[model samples]
Target chain A: MMPVGNLVGMVVRNTVRSPRHFALSAFGIVIGIASFVFFLGLSMGVRNVILGKIFPLEVVEVVAPRASFMGKDITKKLDDGTVEMIRARPEVKEATPRMKVAFPAAGFGMFEGQEIKFEVGGFCDGVDPKVLADDPKLAALFKDWEAAGADDPAKTVACVPPVVDDKGVAGKNPCPDPEFYYCDVQDNRCHRRVPVIVSPTLLELYNGQVASTHGLPVIGDLEQFVVERGGLARMRFTIALGETMVAGSAMATSDKKRRVEGMLIGITPKAMPIGMTVPIEYTRRWNQEFAGDEAASTYSSIVVTLNDKDRLAVFSAWLQEQDLRLEDQLGERFATAIFIVTTLFVLISFTIVTISSINIAHNFFMQVSERRREIGVLRAVGATRTDVKLIILGEAALIGVIGGLLGVGIAFAGAALVDWASATYLPRFPFKPPTYFDFKGWIIAGGLGFSTVFCVVGGYLPARKAAKLPPAQALAAQ
Target chain B: MSEAVIKLRDVKKSYGSGAARTPVLRGVSFEVARGELIALVGQSGSGKSTLLNIIGGLDTADAGDVEVLGHDIRKIGEKELAGLRNSSIGFVFQAFNLLDHLTCLGNVTLPASFTPGAKDVEARGLEALRRVGLVELAQRHPSELSGGQKQRVAIARALFGAPKLLLCDEPTGSLDSETGREVIEFFRELNEKDQMTLVIVTHERRVSSVARRIIAIRDGQLVDGEELALGAPGDAGGAGAGGPA
Candidate 1:
């Protein structure tokens, strides 16, 4: 019986003694493992961003009852009454209504002598601020999130009216704090800018459609565009107070158009595609003045933020009972496509790794043939059959470790390169993930473990062949 | 009354199968008492090496019992045979099978490393080199050593584990006349000074002359014991045994 320590020493010494042999055996594994890690990083990045960041983990979207190609005529509008009713449900923590409107108005102007202008016309949304402000947990979602604020001084707190007595502070409601964009909702008086929660979809649409058509340099993820490119710079725009209008287009009366400076506050999740979310009260005021007897009392959609993810199915079931439909942005077509591509990527990765293992086995067999005399010498000295087998397997394990580490390095470098390219050249890509790769520790470990196990298994048969040789015959081989 | 240190009975060995099968050993038999200096003399393919392999536990006999250091080769498992080989027998080949990658000391220590619970391998290796007068060349690799020095290193490795039996196959077959003579003298010294039990296979007359007993093999069978006899100069100072005490 060979001492285990001596066997280990011999294994290491013999393996390290032949540098060329070691490297050749490990190279195949390195290529295989690197491809596995690289492709996996890509698939995982797309899955997380599409399923996690964009769609979010919990919150579900409920669109109003409307005519659809499916021909399901459920006449329950997602109005304020629906929002209240949904909010009253046990599974629903808070329900926020989202109203869609065309870009109120967009034009370029000089603010502090900096030229700024809206380059595209996107949709907008009117939202009541109470959703985030009242629910601490929901507000917590936007706590650290921020958009590139317009540097216009008028949009700041300078126009904030002082706190008034209970009788009312001059106006029924002044801008609630510095975060509020406007005040004096009773008469639509001018005060600061309008606080708005802009959805990330607006940036995606502009970058994808408007920027490409105009041949402009594309913007990266929302944060980079907002912070580095000053995306919200042109917050001051005048929209027609009438029902239908465009910035440069005409309205029934020019006087009907009102001027308001809008300030971007936070970002809305992509699952809720409502454009820019503004104060619903201000939007109601405009609607009352223009729509005569029919102001939009029902909302375009309601977003139900769940208290617990476990209750999402319950809330979804209840929404169905109320004749509402939960809209999934990731439709069946997109889901099936992702599933097929992801499956293909995984199959390709496993095949490469398995083939590499077989290659490792072939290499070991050749090594055994070349080292037959050496194995005989070891046996002649005193090595048992098990010792010879251990030495061979130990060498294979070392190869696996070296290949695994190299694979991780290659994966990281490739990911970083892809991320840099995405930030610089491919920013308009539909999946606007904050970073193109997420190098989770467990994923890297799995890659390492898989390669090692395959290598050991691959080397087994050759090791046994070497070990079974009779010492006298083996000694005569050379 | 006691058994011999090494024994073989009707050991038969063949290579290949059926029509192509070539018999290498045919019912050959021998015994070596403790401390015997023996020479197994035969031409190449005369089965002397095959008999030595069976005695050393490196090869199994197809039909026979081979006992070395009280362990029956036919009855034991590979692990037990390996242990017997490790603890009781050491081999010196004509090629001086010293691993080129290892220093003289490393090659000498190799056998001890295979023995479980072996400790102070360097100390024991140095001691063996000291006995063989190659302590100064302990750090030199086989490639850098002279033929005589490499044989000395091989001898040192065989003696390192304090093996009970030293088996050499044409140990001087590759050396020149002068080097070969020196290796033979070294073997004589080990046998006489340490009372070491030795079984050497060789065709060289000079090598067999130093042995107390010479067994001639021909065509896988032992030559008649009476002609050459088990003991040469049987009256020469207890022959193989040291003076009484």
Candidate 2:
């Protein structure tokens, strides 16, 4: 066999003998690899948006089992007693009970006078407003959700890291009042924002699927178009309480309705199929006057938050053992779809690459046949069979690496083109991705590396055939 | 005292299998002492090339024991045989099978690439090219060289590492008469001046006349001086002078 120092030169020299054939052989592999990288980048970008922007991993919803009763399915109330029992576990960092507010559709808007009706009658859920202050872990987890950089202007798209005081504690309660955004303390008169948690997915759904159909304005970049607007579009809310309302009545009079002006202070992800959530204390206070029988401080379900996901299994098992079920609210079906799509994309890419490999092998076989005399001469000049094999396989590997790098470059340029076209001409495209592709270093390397290996693997048999050609017969022929 | 560079005893070789099996070398026995210039003369398909290949360690003998440069043929591995070929035997072919892409220097240094940790390959290759009087054509690719120049490069390649035995398979078959004569004279001079042992396989009288001993092969068997009527046609004065080198 040839020495290590000369192997690369020999391979390159042989490959350069017929550049057109080398290019033709590598073209198929390049296409396969480029599409592979493009699809990988798309999937990774989608994952960032779905998981990073929408799902809150630190929170999980727990509900009591309906099997406790024999009648039609009823939500077994999660009273204060149940909340304490579940919170007793060491893994439970914070447990906040939730309640549903019963308000007229006209009452759900920003401020008292400006009536902005929701197409689906926006959800007004309730929870303890002091949950963030009581649980430092939950506050720290959602520090960025409720507050922005203190120095940032109210208009720009900027989100800074959570500031830490000198004592090393993260600054979470940026607002002067923990339970309110804007208020007046004198005369026991205080007007506060209805602190609500609405998912970014809801805004996306409204803009993409629901809003334009219903003749509503499409919301793009909620922080810019909505939150920074500081008007009916964002920082306001209104609630009304009927003084003489009856339960489940067809015509209940609301002549003594109490309208309250509110502001939007905090935003949380409703990761599940739930809607807007507010403080439960506010809901119970309103429900007490509206319906005496429905004013009890019991909840059908509660959300328990943990500091880390490693402790979730133990906590979840403990809950299930106690007839409580858990829901990640991050979507099981969404995760499965991502997994299936990713797998199919990879399999298809490999199938194309494998076909290309076969093409490479068959192409080199032709070259080997053409160079039989050359092989014989090399054998006569002290090159062993192994050396010939190494030379051929080395050429194939070089072609593979070249094709892989070309594929990655093609993918990047292709992604840039897509992003530009979408932004320029298809701005109204329902699911306008923030970016066309996400380029990860390791993934690119892996794609290139795998392609190179497969090329070598594909070259194995043909290289062996080249090596095993009998030198004397080959020399005799020419 | 002169030592035997190549020794073969009862060496046999055949091609194909069963009904198509054709014998090439049948019980061949011979020895060429170190520094002896010999010509293996035979017609086409006379198995002369096969015998030379076996001696060069490029092919294996099927039936008998053979030794080249003190390495037993049947005892060692293929890599060891390759190493033996790399170090002790150099082959020069008729077609001048220099890779078209490599320069003359690159072609000459080809053998050094196979030996592990070979140093000064360029210097040695230039020296060999200089010996062949083609030192000025060292940087020229084979395609850029003339027929005589190509043959000289091939010869320089064979002589690059200075092996113990140089084997030429009709080295001048593709060259014109003048170039062929030049290559033959080059071989004679190397044999006489450098003490380089040589085995030239040819049917040309010009090639065989310069050899010290002309061995004839017919249908896989070595014939005597009287039975060389068909193979050695122009061996009038050169044939019967068979004695010690």
Candidate 3:
């Protein structure tokens, strides 16, 4: 057999002489390889989008029910004690009672003449700024938010009321803290006035309803609004204190159009008991509301903070032992669904790529058949059958390479287009699928290489037949 | 007398089998010694080409002991047979069989390329073309050459590897009388100077007279072998001289 290099050189010389035919065969391989590359990148991009939105790696969200009550509404109250239980777990690095709220809660916010019916679905659950500092992930998110200036000074903690006590010392909550978002009648201190945080989305919607004469609101300043209490209307507005909301506006219940409003107050970590289940007020309220056995009492879920994040499952099992659910945001399910669908799409794209590669192989086989006379001459002149085969295969591989490169080029263009569109229209997560021309380009190149080489393999039998033709008969052939 | 370079003993060859079988050679025997030139004279269907093919190892005889350059033709596989043809036997076809795509030198060097250890093959091919006095035309394609020149290139290709036997199916069949004479002269010179063994299959009496011996075949059977002295010294030729090797 001639050296593989010599065979390759001959193939190159011959195929290069007939550029048009080689280009066509190579184009087929390019399509197959590109499909492979772009599809995989697309799959990864979609996966990133789903996971980025759903299972953001750094977030540690804690959850519990919103309210507590006596009588028939006793079941509605959250068992704040679960928070303390989670905090006591060894994995608990830092814990906070993220207070949530619902509409129909009494508040004294009103307008002139008619009491403003303010349905305040408190979007921003109250959180201490210290929690953001303590959790590196939250700190990073805040830094990004601050860099973007997504909110004003008022929206940031810079201007909010300092968390303090009744004696005028900072770091206190005047009203009793609900274990979750609500309080029982017996946890009487909650009856005192307290503030609620609102999300920017809620603010945007609320701004649409309010007239411009009121001026676009800033985060820290108090905004006047009205509410209804026990069928009677009242005119009131708390000190407009702005706070940032992390996620959605709120979950809508019935279309009852209930009105509730309140001030948003900040609290320090010291204001709540250390490792106490259901901040003191939440426990007191739960006791008053359910009046049930302590062990049987519980909330919907608890957010356990682990000292070592790797132990979340261990703590989760512990929570499960106490008969509680672990609640994740709605995004988790959405991400899972997206991942499944995207994977299927990738598989489908790969199938198309495989079929296209086969087509390329067929085309190369035809190419080899067309060149039988030339091949015969080469073989006659001492070119071994193996040499001819290599030459043919080498041509196939070259075509694959060209085709693969073309596909990767296409993917790069597509990636640029997508990124441009995302930057223009949907800049929420700043997500653009990874560009194909980078690390992922090798994948495409490999695909091209494999397919082209595979195409050569496809034409192997034909090349052999061409090579084995008796030179005498070959010369005599038409 | 020189040792026979090619020998066939009662070679019987037929194509197909059973009802479809047709014999191309019927009990033919011949021996070609070194430095001899012989003509196989016959009509188109008289098996001259088949006889040439068998000698060249391009075809097999059903029953025969055929040898070329000390290798049993029947015992070798197709690949080995091809190797035998490459290294030991050279063919000059009626059509000139010069590859149209190659230059004259390329055509000449083609057979050498298949030869093992054919180093400096380009130089060797050039030298062969020079020997044929067509070295100046080396770069030109076969189409650019006249019929005589094309035949000369074919002859140069045959001479490239210095084969033990040169088989010419019809060296002058496609040429004019003058060109045919020139080709015959070239063959006569090659045989006398190089001591080359030559086998010419032809229907032309003019082509046959140039050979020291002639074998006639009619309808796939050997008809006669005769010596045509033509004033050559110490010559006793034909199938009588081509007795058992």
Best by lDDT: 2
Q: Who is ahead in DockQ, 1 or 2? A: 1
Specify the CAPRI tier of model 2.
medium
Give the per-residue lDDT digits (tens) of candidate 2, residues B1-245.
Answer: 25877777888999999999999988878777787788988999999999988888777788887888888877888788778777778899998989888899999998887888888889999999998899998889999988999999999999887888899999999999999999999998888788888989999989987887777888888865222222223445444333321
**Order of the predicted models by DockQ, top scorer first:** 1, 2, 3
Task: Report the interface RMSD that candidate 2 achieves against the true structure, in angstroms.
Answer: 1.5
Please give me the DockQ of candidate 2 compared with the native complex: 0.64
Native contact recovery (fnat) for each candidate is 0.74, 0.60, 0.19
**What does DockQ give for each predicted structure?**
0.65, 0.64, 0.21
Residue pairs in candidate 1 whose N, alpha carbon or C atoms collide under 3 angstroms: A79-A298, A79-A299, A181-A193
The lDDT values for all models are 0.72, 0.73, 0.58
Worst 10 residues of 3 chain A by lDDT: A269-278
lDDT per residue as tens, model 2, A115-223: 4544212255676655657445334322222233422132232223236589654444333442343222222233334445555566667677777776666665544
TM-score of 2: 0.81
The positional error of residue B92 in candidate 2, measured at the CA in angstroms, is 0.3
Candidate 3 regions with alpha-carbon error over 4 angstroms: A23-27, A52-380, A383-398, A410-442, A467-472, B111-118, B225-241
Model 1 TM-score, all chains together:
0.78
Docking class of 1: medium
Instruction: Give the candidate number with the greatest TM-score.
Output: 2
Error of 2 at B49 (Å): 0.5
For model 3, residues A1-478, the per-residue Cα lDDT tens digits are: 5545545555665667677776666665556555666666766666555444324422355543344556444333345565666677777776655443222222333444333333222322333344546545323322212123433232222222335468534333223332112211222222222333233333333444443445533222222232122111121233212211223433233233322123332222222211111122333232333233542343333334457645656765775576444566444565557668656755665665566556656776676566665564554444556666667667766666566678778766776776677667762322233332232555665666666665666566666666666554555555
